[model samples]
Target chain A: MRIAELSRRSATSIPSIKYYLREGLIPGGRTTGRNQADYDEAHVRRLRLIRALVDVGGLSIAAVRDVLAAVDNPDLPGHDLLGIAHHAVSPTPARRDPDDPRWQAAREEVVTLIGERGWLVSPCSPALDVAADAIAAMRALDQADLLSSLPTYVEAVERMAAWEVAAVLARGEPARMVEGLVTGTILGEILIGALRRLAQEAESARLQGLTAPE
Target chain B: MRIAELSRRSATSIPSIKYYLREGLIPGGRTTGRNQADYDEAHVRRLRLIRALVDVGGLSIAAVRDVLAAVDNPDLPGHDLLGIAHHAVSPTPARRDPDDPRWQAAREEVVTLIGERGWLVSPCSPALDVAADAIAAMRALDQADLLSSLPTYVEAVERMAAWEVAAVLARGEPARMVEGLVTGTILGEILIGALRRLAQEAESARLQGLTAPE
Candidate 1:
């Protein structure tokens, strides 16, 4: 296969493919002639993964690069690879004032939630920051009731996370396991976010006594 | 109160507050004199809401404008206001080819999931598209098993959505209800995503027989 076929198969523009190649997001194809290059199945797969991460997962180019590097590194432990991928995919939160009362309260709530759930998360995990930031945002907006159902949400995510870790660990190949973890971590968020919206709509309709129009 | 006060109180920079005013994402304060305007408590609250939506919710400026307009409209029903907010905050997905077998299959899966859960979502809901697009992405990445836990995730979100809707309805004022819904819908996703990651970390550590470093 050539670059043209790669573009056609991946549904990516030729210019975009070239840009990705230049950015080293996708490896260079084999040089078959002075200007012609031959791509293979690996290129196709790589292109698709890049598209999935960027287009659907909303990862930045730099983040994508880091995630790919983690995926390609054979020496990186599976859990550590997941950590890198997680850090890459999640946006860096704006720094919160450590002394703000709302932030302090939210941080305490997060710590309490962890203790109550008995989750073995590190105190330094970025996820705690993400959750606490959200909690502070809710408080600023005066919508504290949103956090009232924290326990239920925790239960739900615990079960899903257990399943995800098991699925990732079940893969025999380290490379495949890393790839699966990356994809699952990023795409799973998209899937869950979308599903939650749909559920809200459905629940809204039911509460309003509205039927889905056929 | 002036622009500086609004900025100081909201913890946003003067230039950013001016930018928001120029962009009409926030209503201008009353013009009391030349090169001066008197902002009030309402302005402070609105600025906070805008920051929460943009900073935490990751909504675009245009989406924020639309959501604010929906919130300001007095005649819009509370539920309808929420609908508008949901539509605005969620990015419009790139159109997928209807003929793509994977997309078609994913669409069917979305419909089937809704039906299985007895959800009352309309066929035209944008959330259906969002969910289907995510499913297609998962399939493209060859991580289709990620969707296998869809049932559990659905159960969780359904309960959360119900709680969210009930909380919104509990607000007596229409404006307050709309604000609460918008904040919950957007910030709630951030909170859940963070919590899910934290849960994954905990589960991974437990499964791997590792303890979090103190």
Candidate 2:
């Protein structure tokens, strides 16, 4: 079938299909000279996987590439896949210098704290470190311990890991799992969207109550 | 106090402090020229906010910067913070060719889908589009539609939000909302993780029972 057919069958557009092809994220079909090319079931399957990781999983092109690479490689471990997802969700960028001592200090504190947890995280991203530094300065203003946030974070990470594992299992089969994941991911964003509003509402009320005069 | 002294006081580090200084994410502190500088409380508060946005909010620096900028602008509406956070999670790199048809179609599809949902999303990031495309492909192979998963996600997101909101309200002040967000995010992750494992168990039992009858 042609790209247009694949797009139509897949419920995607021809242009979008071409973009995937250009990115080499999707394999190309056999060229038939002029304006025609042929695709098969494999193309359909690949296109779907590409969409799942990118759209639902919220990964970058590079990140999606790594994930696809792993999924295609039979020897890859499940742990690596999860790690890839985690990395995809938390892609890092370059960093810059801090403006004050306190900002600088916060970076060190978080890195040390995260390190002490023995999670084997890569060196804190330069950007994160910079963010931490700015936070350090902020910490100076109020009297809060930098380490006070740790126990809660640990508890959270554990809970998250459990959730992902359970969600995927509900999928039944790998293909179904991908479907479930894809469905879950988009819905997950909406859920977050609604919840954020909910949280804000409650928080706003609490803030007013707490700060009100007796 | 000097950088080292502030570092000791905050339980943070020196290199991190310097890194933050360079990033321009934080403001400059008092300088004594040659080898002297002063630090204070304001720096501390900033540090905490920075750390919360990065570690807990999972925002990148560029996203964080936009947020900080908006937050600093008293004229800017506060309700938009969540929207910013939402955009922060999208991938950033742009790699599509100017004439890519498939890319354009997929991009339009995603933007339209998100908009139709009444979600106030940021401009489409091409890099994110590619990743989402991969997931889209994978989801096409699944058994369910996007709407099917909403119920589970809605319940989970709301539950977490309730717990988090309750926690903040009980704290006597709404300042811990960042903490509230963190708790909610972590709980969601954990919930997903638990569900993943439980599903696998359920499947195994069902499969075993079905096969045993034969």
- TM-score of each prediction: 0.79, 0.45
Every candidate's DockQ is: 0.59, 0.07
State the lDDT of candidate 1 residue by residue for B158-205, as single tens digits. 888888788888886655666676778777887888999988888877
By summed lDDT, the worst window of 10 consecutive residues in model 1 chain A runs over: A172-181
DockQ, prediction 1: 0.59
Best by lDDT: 1
Worst 10 residues of 1 chain B by lDDT: B172-181
Q: Report the TM-score of chain B alone for all candidates.
A: 0.81, 0.56
RMSD of each: 4.5, 11.0
* Ten-residue stretch with the least lDDT total in model 2 chain A: A141-150
Give one digit per residue, the lDDT tens place, for model 2 in A103-160: 6676667556544643333342332453363344334434243224335434443343
Task: Report residue A100 deviation for candidate 2 (angstroms).
Answer: 10
